[model samples]
Target: TQLLEQSPQFLSIQEGENLTVYCNSSSVFSSLQWYRQEPGEGPVLLVTVVTGGEVKKLKRLTFQFGDARKDSSLHITAAQPGDTGLYLCAGGGGGATNKLIFGTGTLLAVQP
Candidate 1:
């Protein structure tokens, strides 16, 4: 089993604004991943951070992993209405099962 913590449990922003979400943990894992989830259906994997201090960007989204591999962050540039949803961070054991320990998560609401 694994555990994670997220900050600013809730965020509300206007379209074209910028925001950031963070995930932190005391435990280390082989890999860390970010997902954007809407209601009903399963979460969609946004990106994965394996090495410490790794940084990746997807369009207006930027993801960063902590140097110690114990934390991660997601930054959104010029947020849009479609960006409204639940953002989650999950950790992997680097094993064969692809098992995940999910973070409590942060909720983002972008109002147009």
Candidate 2:
């Protein structure tokens, strides 16, 4: 049973605030991806970390993969109203079932 759990299913914050979202699992993954989705649209890939303890940064967003490949994290610095959206984490096993497994999902609202 491979499952991914995410904390803080919902978040509301003021502009310029910092926030972190977590993704955890009991099974190892070959790769992990972070995505941000808007209303009525597909999620946009934010980052993909393949190696354990790998870290990647995109502008104000930072992503980290767990050393065991069973967890990941996303940190946003100086969050703005424009950052309000749904954040999703997906894991890839890299086998015959290379399909991604998504977390429950997170909704973030950044008030101006």
For each candidate, what TM-score against the reference?
A: 0.94, 0.97
- What are the runs in model 2 whose C-alpha is more than 4 Å off? none
Over 1-107, each residue of candidate 2 has an lDDT whose tens digit, in order, gives 67999888999999999999999999999999999999999999999999999999999999999999999999999999999999999999887968999998989
Alpha-carbon RMSD to native, per candidate: 1.2, 0.7
Q: 1-112 in candidate 1: lDDT tens per residue?
A: 4679998899999999999899999988889999999999799999999999999999999999999889999999999999999999999867788899999989999999
Best by TM-score: 2
State model 2's lDDT: 0.95
TM-score of 2: 0.97
Q: After superposition, how far is residue 88 of candidate 1 from its true place, in Å?
A: 0.4
Worst 10 residues of 1 by lDDT: 1-10
Give the true-structure RMSD of model 2: 0.7
